[model samples]
Target: MSAGTSQETPATARGGLFVTFEGIDGSGKSTQCRMLADTLRARGLDVVLTREPGGSDGAEEIRRLVLEGDPDRWSAETELLLFTAARRDHLERRILPALAAGQVVVCDRFADSTRMYQGLSRGDLRASVDQLHRLMIGHEPDLTILIDMDPAKGLARAKGRQGSEERFEDFGLDLQQRMRAGFLALAQEFANRFRVIDGDRPMDVVAQDVLDVVAAALPERDGDAGA
Candidate 1:
């Protein structure tokens, strides 16, 4: 993490910078999250790289329950509650503490994900998602990086992964298309905190754009990570 002081945001009261990545399935947000963390760590900054739905031990358990079952296994409402619960645990156990300790927190997905997946895709529960978020997880990331991709391409990449967490991908390409649109709408809804980047490019190209957006959001770093 860059030892250079990060800007304070109303969304994050703690000292650390809170960055989140969001996109349709297989948009490479997870890979980018890891790359960003690695880059920051190499610079000597204190960083905490984590993911939603499975960041904390408890959340990980819920992740399997929601992600491994059949697509019709749970109603949209039930899934929303489960995801919110997992997010709450993740926030309290991992995010809050890391921020309080003044470490940069880079999360692969956050509430905006719930806003897209549960709120828009599965059903018209965007209002409920916001209500639960305000009631349970009142915080938001300081910066949100939205990776925009062609839904079909993203779905193909997602299915190609052959991972156990295939519940969402099983929803098929139509759902992926809707989700891509929903995410773009969300980026507009929270324009100030969001930075949308085209994800159809090479990994290095996408990563460079992500880094540039992040750098614009943060203060210039002059000190070493250990400083």
Candidate 2:
């Protein structure tokens, strides 16, 4: 929370909506991000569905390195730099372009994830996270949807995915619990843009709740006079 002072969107910004989904691992934010993008596109809105650490080509390369290796493959400091580099590429090539063109940007994860994963989990590097963010990435999402879920359930779901990106999940339940608390605290820290949603419900029900929240926040475009 940069103490309530933030640089407004870069001048090229039109009335674009930058939406990012964030939560503890397996909170189903990725699903909701997809659903929201599809729903908004159905309404004839130009929505750019993207994800951090892997949105653009360069970032996607970085993703393979950070997410596929062992949990301890990189130290927290090194991981932070790698993630920031990826995000910078993502914002430069994908997110910012879409926003400048007045398109909706729906991202699976963003800086907030790093703020917790690296900022708190390994050590107290939160100030470093904030400082780096302010210096490198000066923008925040217009809306951030946090799907809250019990760490135990979330961890089970994450491990069940059995994907190559298990590096983070491999850190175990303790890390998930800490991340859950960190995310919730972040919601308080950035109350203006954070909307917490219960992720324990049926997927469809939770999706609807997410949709309703986003539909309200989105600015009415010419073709999207109503969501």
Candidate 3:
């Protein structure tokens, strides 16, 4: 792992797990992320639930700047820079600490979001995005749960939600379609650490699949794996 992307202490080495959820908007990954965290905690595990662009104090401030403004407020490159800065702060202030304390850190989104977003928004900047990550943020989650869903449905779900954070969500179906493909490709590229969950099922079913993936990856303490 690169210095900028590494946890203060390796999560596995410290009995912690860092898991991230990624998907196009309305993929239900957010709900599943929370559900998984709750399930883990109920099983007697320490769990920290956080989200990208706004996990740590500093990152939250950056999130406001990135998510609340006009869509074109910042150029693609500048926006990616802002995201990287926020991610760095999130790692240093919240995520890394939780992992060092042996807590499962479940992030709603991580570096992969940047990779896909920029790849879709500013197609030519994908290389820059990867380079920046390599130079300043070089860590991968123990597992990434990609809630795969149809873009049209995902877009409708995102638009139906009430939020001022529609900057990304407002990109519409076409972009969401591309993002879905990007995430699937990413899953293939990082198959060892990626779980592509079919999210078209009922919420309960989706949540259970997510739980199963996580439980299998990080067996619970004592006899709690099935808990």
The TM-score, computed over Cα atoms with residue i paired to residue i, of candidate 3 is 0.92
Name the runs in model 1 displaced over 4 angstroms: 1-12, 219-227
lDDT (tens digit, per residue) of candidate 2 on 196-226: 9999999899988988887787765544434
- TM-scores of all candidate predictions against the true structure: 0.92, 0.94, 0.92
Instruction: Between candidates 1 and 2, name the one with more favorable lDDT.
Output: 2
**Candidate 1 backbone overlaps, count:** 3
lDDT of 3 by residue, 1-227 (tens): 53234343335765678989999999999999899888888888888999998899999999999987577778888889999999999988998888788788999999889988874554667778877887787677888999999999998998899799988777677789889998998888777788999999999999999988888777345235545
C-alpha positional error of residue 225 in candidate 2 after TM-score superposition, expressed in Å: 5.8
Residue 68, candidate 2: how far off, in angstroms? 1.2
In model 1, residue pairs whose N, Cα or C atoms come closer than 3 Å (at least 3 residues apart or on different chains), thus clashing, are 1-40, 1-45, 44-225
Could you tell me which 10 consecutive residues in candidate 3 have the lowest summed lDDT? Answer: 1-10
Encode model 1's per-residue lDDT on 1-227: one tens digit a residue: 11012232343467777899999999999999998888778877788999988899999999999999699999999999999999999989999999887778899999888988888899999888887877788788889999999999999999999999999999999999999998888887778788999999999999888877766655345234322
How well does candidate 3 score on lDDT at residue 210? Answer: 93
